[model samples]
Target: MGFSDGVIIVLGLALFEIISSIDNAVVNADVLLTMSERARKWFLFYGIIIAVFVVRGLLPLLIVWASSPGVGFMGALTATFSNDASVRDIIERQKPILLAGGGLYLVYLFFYWLFVEPKEYAFFFESHIHRKLSFWFYAVASALLLAVVWITIRINPFIAFGAVVGSTAFFITNGFKHNAEQAEKEIAHSKMTDISKILYLELLDTTFSIDGVLGAFAFTISVPLILLGNGLGAFVVRYVTIHGAKTVRKYRFLKNGAMYSIGSLGAIMLAEAMAVHIPVWTPTFITFIVVGLFFWLSARELKAEKIIA
Candidate 1:
């Protein structure tokens, strides 16, 4: 990639990470409210280190290594910047499987929000779908998986297996999130120790980090770029969590924008996995357009509410 292209990809990845983690930031802020000031400071300090370096930095490398073990761990780390054609070939061959898994997870995440998760209705269809189709979420998800696996199995059984693993990861993380929500409620009222609260928050961050890490793949496969963009994004999220959670909550439709961009990226990844041609910049382009549109709508609504008040 050219310098400009690299710059764009990094920016896009950072934007994606920040927007997608807004909810996580909100949750962190809320939980921090229950903790002592000292604990809060610790989390904001040490917690960010773990988040940026361990979760955002290493997770991408781990995913790459896990997907292409033949490349070896160090090889996976430097594979993106390597001049060796053989390493490049290994990565290229593994891209489809990696894309398949991550794509399904993202697509399912979007649908989960649309169908089952409670939210402010950004569009009319969201409310209607939530009310009418919410009960069928499991059925829909199952059928989608069946169809994906059936088609993928014909092309490559390993790809189909990857899709299955992706869906499994989604449900596993989904369960953690659901439990975290319940735990957050409990933590708010109960006399949980500051240390315990810190631990809980760290665990929560890890669960939330999975989404950003996987989504980063859709933006770029370069582990270094992913680490840089996502690390910067993590810092931005921490800042927002500390200072601007309320401001962010006011822009209610921003989450909607994030979800839409996620769904778009999921589609793009799936298409690419199926050997369809997509421009390298398509994910970034779609993300900017979708997010920009929703942000405008959010600002308009916020202004209207302020005027009424």
Candidate 2:
């Protein structure tokens, strides 16, 4: 590529990565809100490295290795991403698993939030169905999830298998049984260990970035260049997450918006798993647009109350 062309690709990838990760920034910010200032800084620094290098960069390569057991790691790595067609094929073959895993994981966050703290919400919007249904909302979430898996199973049992694995992973790793227990255990997971939160953010980053490099493929297949350009965006998002955490700590509505974004991502993932193929950037843009509107509204409401008081 010419110098100008290379620069354009780098800039395009960075911009795309930043816009796509806004929801990720919001989610991480909320989790980091629970940590100490020092802890937050530490986690953000380490988390960004892990998220960019391990999650976005390395994990997909590992997936390439894992998916093709017969091939040597180096061979699988090269063949899988040797070009746009090769990379796209791998992603297509694994789409069911990726979507199933990512979608269920996202959905579980929303379910956990609702069951654990129904009163805490974002954007001042409540699902009438959720409110009226109350505890039965658990059943609703489950049935819907299972129904999606079942649909995928009919198309490809592997997809259903992936969905089950994703949901089970969330249940086990997230300490779900305890969260499901008496109300007192609520927020227990929110107070997760530094290590646990680190892992949480890492998984979110990995799943969030599964589709990320697809856009990068539009430009180049040189893994090092891909990492360099995308890593720039990764660093920026980490800073945003820290700043976002601080803002969320101050603004309850922003936290709620993050929760809704989590749920929306889950829905989008599930939809894609069912072969709906929503554009990757759709959720990312919609999330920020919706959140921005609510943030503005909440700011106005807060200012009005201040004046009245």
Candidate 3:
């Protein structure tokens, strides 16, 4: 890829990561309010290293390496940048499985938010779906999984398995997230030590970071680029957690924007995995447009609310 293209992709990945994790940042900010200054400082200082290098960096590398074990860990790391056709071919062969798994996970995430999670409605259909179909989230998820697997299995059984893995991942992480929400509430209200809260926050951060890391694939398959983009995003989230979480919370429709961008990315990934062609820059541009539109709506809503109050 050219330097300009790489720059755009990285910027897209970073923006997507930042917006997607706004909820996590808000939660982190809430818990930090209960901690000592020293504790907050330690978490912010050391936590960034873990969040950036360890979680954001290592997770994608691990995903690539695990998917393409033939490409040694180092090989997988450099494969995207490598000019060697053989190396590129190996990565190409494995890309669909990786994309399939990650795509299903992402699509499921979007649907869960639309059907089950409570939110300030961004569109009329969102509220209608939640009110009437919330209980059918599981049924919808199951049917979606079945359909994806049945379609992919005829073409490639492994791709089908990858979709199953993705669904499994969604359930496992969703359970953890539900539990973490309860934990965060209890920790916030209790006499938990600063050290304990910090550890809990770190764990929570890791869980949340998974969404961004997986979504990063929709932008590019390059591991180094993923690291750079996601690393920058993690820093932004930390900064917002410290300085701008309240300001961010006021723009409520931003979450709607993030979820919709996620669904778009998921569709892009799934289509690519099915041998359809998409421009390398498609994910990046689509994300920018979707997020930008929702941000405008949010700003308008905030302005109207202030005038009323």
Ranking by lDDT: 3, 1, 2
By summed lDDT, the worst window of 10 consecutive residues in model 1 runs over: 76-85
Q: Write model 2 residue lDDT over 126-150, tens digit each, in one string.
A: 6554465567656766896678777
Per-residue accuracy of model 3 over 150-204 as CA lDDT, tens digit each: 8889888988888899999999999889898778767877898999999988888
**Candidate 2 vs 3: which has more TM-score:** 3
Error of 3 at 124 (Å): 1.2
lDDT-best of 2 and 3: 3
Deviation from native of the Cα of residue 55 in model 2, angstroms: 4.3
Candidate 1 positional error at 224, Å: 0.5
| lDDT by residue (tens digit), candidate 1, 209-228 | 88888888888888888988
RMSD of 1: 1.8
